[model samples]
Target chain A: MTQSPVVRLQDVTKKIGGRTIIDRISLEVYPGEVFGFLGPNGSGKTTTIRMMVGLMSITSGDILIGGHSIRKEFPQAIRQVGAIVENPELYRYLTGYQNLVHFARMAPGISRSRIDEVVRLVGMESRIHDKVKRYSLGMRQRLGVAQAVLHRPRLLVLDEPTNGLDPAGIRELRDYLRKLAREEGTAVFVSSHLLSEMELMCDRVAILQKGRVVDIRAVRRDSESSEAAPDDVWFDVERPEEALRVLDGLGKGRIEDGRLAVTADRKTVAEINRKLVEAGFSVYGIRVKTKTLEDQFLEVTRGESVG
Target chain B: MADFLRLLQNENMKIYRRVGTWVMYAFIIGIPLVMSLAIISVTPEDPPSNWLFMFIASNILASLIAIFTVVKAADAVAGEFSQGTIKLLLIRPWRRSSILLSKFLAMLLFGLALTAAAFTVTLVVGTAFFGYTASPEDMFSEMGRKNPWGYMLLWYLYQFISAVAVASFAFMMSAAFRSGGLTIGLSIFILLAGGLITNLLSLLDKPIVKYTLFPHLQLTSYLDGGPGPLPQYPMTLGFSLAVLGVHFAVFVAVAWLAFGRRDVA
Candidate 1:
């Protein structure tokens, strides 16, 4: 929290042909965090990202990267970031290695060894010399990731990055993004409709509807920094009724599904567990029931078509 | 400027890596060789001088070169849109104007390399088959040009300018419309129609013919200090060049405006 935000959008608006596509959206993304962007179809997630990366014009206000305005200082603002606006549309005629080399020439100071490093990192070594036309959708996705991180950018922006990835490839992309953020302090801004995928990969999420941000909140309730937050924790034990009564004073515990469900923070819940054990109550299992992102998404979207 | 070169390198890689581009270059080099050899075989006893063959072969090759150049220019900007690669290309640190300029320069370089290849083959084969004569300068000295080599050089320069004008027109269309086929078709139409309009307009005595682009399209005629290819106009070479220059500026202005202001979706 001490460091400045890596990306900040100030009342950014986009109007195309007299219709507002994005209406005064504002937020900030800091270093070493994965910020998820979510919206139904035609909700303007792609338009907002287009403006942030300097692909589209900002009708009002501004998008800043590393404190430089994208409108006035595009080269300066965009220089610190790497982005893929939609699909990773690369040249299909050239080899994957040639495609990487072609893009590496556009940015400054990207060495040959660095291209090799990214190729290896993305697991494209064996097919790096093959033509991209021969690559599968998932292989193209991996190559897309390789190119986006080739310059070691401070901020990485991806739109629908997991569109065609298999389960294993998607998992690899998630881990790679986390590693990039953790080790390189890169702030990742990603948009995907897979609520479950975003729930697993993102640190925090901003839900967008009708060209507006409706909510921004943490993805996981068990984050230590939010230890004071009362999460819905369930405990399965030998005596659900007796255990519920033992912790009744500390929290509002009730028996549901023949288990004790309590709304309490980790600290107070730990205290309740100690008291239960001291009273000869055996605790068999403990789990934090995270509210599914799909539920929250549908709740915020008001059950509208996810288009 | 160094950064600009790297962008140019990227554009060049995209251009030359295509198999179709190589085929275009092949026609450029191959057609001239075959034509020169045909001339030698048909009239082995007394073929025309090298300068004469050079002049005849150049006229045919220039039209082909212009078509090829315009095709590449049309693809320079519109191809990115068709391939959906413009988004990835534009998100870099460089300005939009810089990216466009790199593509423009690459198209021109491709044209230059093709023209140079055709010129070398035509001249080399033309001289070997027809045999060079020392007194050919006298034959071509009708319009105050005494040096045959210099005269041919001026012809090539003027031909290149015409090609530039055609490519610029094609480039403007593609940049503004984001449709390569439309630009290519329209440019080739204009190129072929210019010749027909020139012949048709010469028959008319109207003063409007003086300002028509068809008269000025063949810029090489002004090398003789005459009234140019279409003598009905009697306009100076400077006036013709000025017209082309103004048109060039207009094409570039429209291209820059459309490309710089467009919001790529």
Candidate 2:
């Protein structure tokens, strides 16, 4: 079976003011998946996203959205992609509804009802009648999101959507975005510096460092036991030499600081313990170390220098 | 076509919503009213010749409207870039040329509307206070019994054309300089300083000074006879039009090329 990605960038490079902002970055976001783009500040996450949506031209590379080449069919590519780069500026004098209506007109075939639907979806229905200048920062962000998704784009790209939001507002935005991707089956590519938010919200994540994709991994679940479970079974044995022999036999274990760390299923740990006991090695204790997303992210992105 | 209309509607909405626009309108009308009242209270007989009155009124109104036009159009593209809204618009399924053209047309319309409003008020007030009658024949007549309908037509066209020329220059400055204030200041400086530079240069009695854009920007002067000691020449009119055309074309070309290649980050 072949699955087409909602958004894809191939060897994208962007140079600005004699510096490479995005350096040969390639990424793919699958349909109906929330792909988190996590990076430090100035890591080219926003630049990459902007190029994907045709907001900024690529210095040297190609971006495809919904099977359309961004350079050749920018409007078609952009038609399927909804994006908010940095702060989403709105017409301050117009009401929230009016702003949505104005943007909606830009998207051909979008009706007034669609505008109302998006306003309600973003939970700005109550305040949609008020002028945008009266809106608080969170309210404006919500309206920005509403304007982005009004045309029901297949791929939604948001750059730091929760930047200035309060805790409550951030939570609300997170929940709203989660529900949006889940219910609408839209592919969401969200770039943020907040790793914890990505861990909580994204189905999968691509960690970027200095315009390079350092790692791509699925979100770990605490309750589900699987082969990919990041729990390292650490065994502290009496004889480090014998432990190494036994761990070598296990084929997936590494000895570090007199302990045998093995990547194995929960049931296999007991077999390894029995083998260590059979080999005349005293096993002091066995502990399962759960790996956090931050650990994985740090491991992937560490030592990468910015271009 | 629909998109163009929508853009025009949005532009009009922006003009109406801005506080600056209203302030400019009030100033345009207010100055003419004050001037009319002052002239009426001071002058006992006919206030002045129609040509003199027109010259004074056109100069004042055009100067004010031109300044406002520079301010408004200077920010047309630059403001969007600063406000971070250009990305949203550019990401839409629209061509860059269309967007730029829409803005240019909107600014042109804005200048024309402002001029019309000021002219209407000034004409009414001047007629009421000065009692200067302007008949169809007077409109057609020129100095030394020369038929100036062609000149007047050229003058009216220049009302929009010169404003467009100023707008184009402002746009170029806007594209080059990201700051709205700097772009506006530079545009106004050029608009006013060009005349000063030309006047200073004319003291040398150089022939090339006639070719400068500043010497012929006065579209109204053509309607009156001509400017300075220079006699009316078909070459002068042609030269002025050509210079302005080139300035306008160069401004737009540079703006488009710079804008098209710019990084919107």
Candidate 3:
């Protein structure tokens, strides 16, 4: 999109005692984008988010938000950022509105209207005045988002935003986050173990394993080749044996329900189709099954366990 | 300066929002009024001096205020960590030192407010029963410097200093521990047992007891010209203040070091 980066992490590394928790990692999050951070359990995802917001100290390297360095100029850097680490830990004694007001008072120049605007933006207008202890987990999550965006932060960071949400709540959060990025142009940096949600929500995702960024990939349509690898393509032909014979060069063909299923890429599938037509076989239909995000995630992190 | 004020305001709001805070305020004010009523009912003709009445009532209420201060101070930082609100609190524009200082100042303000409330109630109840009469002799039995206003001021000052010591100790514990309940419990134990331990040590007639923090907390005895808690071991007000001052600084320093370096996970 050629937009200036809203958040930048440069060669960040963290060491605890004698063990390194986060190895050198560098990335950027631009405005109007939802960037996903994916990692296995104890892969330093939370630690990295903590360092970004200055909740935990960075052993080395720097994080810049809107060109302000977090290590050297924390107040200036953190001023443009809002975050909720782990869970939204709010005061149960106060109302959701009160919680927002309390946080707004800390951030400079946040007017009452801004508070109201964020409330409406998060769709918490109906129950904003209710005490937080009475609100559900989903409602609290929404309130957390409202508080984080009260000052219209340039970047919003959330660690496991959909931890305890139900399916409907997850969908609502996903849609709201997308809308937030599109409408407000706030760069969102979210970390989660839910690969499906990350696939649907994020424009790009960085996968980490053993405290290292193993891969950075574009998600959804931005991905150059969703079918670059071979997939199972099924063909319903007049003679399954003939189709199997025609596709035998590509991969092993298995017959199921009067159809020949063969593993091949798009090019190979097209070549097989052309070969079948030339061989005088009636090919009624050919369907290519695409791989889901879960399948890809499993393949990428084949040996590692995901929390 | 505005940022500091906002941090203080946020801390104040967090404190005042708790039902426990209001209940504490009520207890501080209510207990004094209730005591005055009982005393008035018992003594029909005795004309107690307003100053004396307030002095006696506040002296008793000061201990209660100390307990409340301990509770408030103990919850200042540790409660935030336990409730997970520290994450939100620390992410603001203010520095951790500023946030910690604000929470400490708010707890002090709460202690001051409770002390003021107790003093005001004592004044009101004493005036209602005995009229506005300042009897220096009735209040101060020690024969030196019979200025009633100065004496009463020193009494309140002593009570406030004691409150600060207890609050600082609790605040240090708060910064050191994550569990608010444990902090409060340990503080209460120290508040009561620490005094007893000092007194027990005083009975040993050792010269080292003079340096302990508990003995120095009794700055009131110096003002009253009394022999003090340990009659054999005497201390000047300056010496006592120096000792308490050292303890206060140590407590605050420990709290700052612990809070500044905490990982905040």
Candidate 4:
């Protein structure tokens, strides 16, 4: 909590052709944390990332990487950050090792050993010598990760890195990103439409809708639960129909697998349980199922097509 | 400075790593060697061969270098955009200008390498075929310049300038367009037809052709202190240089501005 943020975007805005692509969104990503950026198809996730990495100009506000402003001091600010905007965008003709070496030359103090270390870190030792054109999408993605981390950047930003990856590749990338955040103490910022991946990989997520930061939620709910609804409470009882009858005032109840499932807060669940017990029903068990990020995202960005 | 060198190295790596680049190099060297061999084989037993003729023959090879330079420059920026590698370059610590300048320098070096290769081959083969002696009657003084070797160097200087101009135009197009094929195709068209268009315009006698880039690109005509290739052309060497300089500046400015503002989506 005390560590200073590795990246800070203060009221960043981008407008193109009289229409705002991103509107005054501000957030910070700390070191050693995986921050997820989630939005629908045209919700400005990539636009914000492009602005952060200096690929696109910010119409207003600024992004600071390691305390250097991207607009004012682009070279210095970008030196502390490594990013792949959309795809890996590598030189396909060159070998994967050559691609890494080519990028490493642009960064200061990146030695041969460091390149080797990153190559090993991404588990691309065997195929690093092969041409990238010959690499599979997964291999290219791993090579991308290796290239992005070669300089040990303070902040690593990847936009849709897992777009074309298989499930195994996505898992590998998630594991590697976590390792980078934990072992290298690098701040990892990734944007994805895959809510499950974001749930598994990120520590905190910021949801964007229509160029605005709609909500920033922690992936783990234990630290903060106020924003979370109580849960869908399911009760296993001797008499499901009796339990449902006792829960008439609550939300709609469904009986499945000899248990009653009802959407309720903690107090309502307790009240239902007490009523069921008083009404001659054996309340064997009660389970509260917390909502996943997918459920919350659908609820938050309701009525908008995911695109 | 060190960073610029690294950028140049990266550009060079990308350039030379392609199989097509090697093929272009081979063509530049191979075509001249074959032509000189043909000339050597067809000489009659009477007339003495002149080595300067080989240099003259090699002078035509400059256009080949120019064409190659045009294609390389056309691919330098636009090709990266097409292949999506520009994002990798754009995200680096170097400025956008640095990345572009490095690519330009790499293309320049490529043109120079081709020119150098052709020059070496012509000189070596010309000496071997003609015994390295200049016949007084055919001392290349009729080419309107004495000292054939010095004249050849002057010819190369002018040719290099023209090649730079062509490549610069192509580089500008490369920055402006996302399609490498479009950039290369349009540049080759311009390079091939540009001079003819200027000559056609010159016949109109409207004085507008004097300011166009094509006529001044024949810079070698002014090397001999003569009236240049087009006697009807109304510009002096200084005027031609100024015009070419203006075009070069414009080409570079267009490239810089386009590249700086382009959204690398």
Tell the DockQ for candidate 2.
Answer: 0.49
**Greater-TM-score candidate between 1 and 3:** 3
TM-score of chain A of each: 0.83, 0.82, 0.86, 0.86
Candidate No. with top DockQ? 3
DockQ of each: 0.69, 0.49, 0.82, 0.78
Taking the true A–B contacts (Cα pairs closer than 8 Å), what share appears in each candidate? 0.87, 0.52, 0.84, 0.81
Candidate no. 2 TM-score = 0.86
Instruction: Give the candidate order by descending lDDT.
Output: 1, 3, 4, 2
Query: Which 10-residue window in model 1 chain B sums to the lowest lDDT?
Result: B137-146
* Candidate 1: residue B126 lDDT (0-100): 76
The parts of candidate 1 lying over 4 Å away from their true place are A221-290, B136-146, B198-206
Candidate numbers sorted by DockQ from highest down: 3, 4, 1, 2
Query: Which 10 successive residues of model 3 chain A have the least lDDT summed?
Result: A220-229
After superposition, candidate 2 runs with Cα above 4 Å error: A16-19, A227-230, A233-288, A303-307, B44-55, B128-157, B224-234
Residue A280 error for model 3, in Å? 7.0
Best by lDDT: 1
DockQ of the two-chain complex in candidate 3: 0.82
Q: Is candidate 2 or candidate 4 better by lDDT?
A: 4
Against the reference, the lDDT scores of all candidates come to 0.87, 0.77, 0.85, 0.84
- Model 3, B169-264: lDDT tens digits are 999989988678988898888777877888799888788998887876667787656666567877677778888899999999999999987787
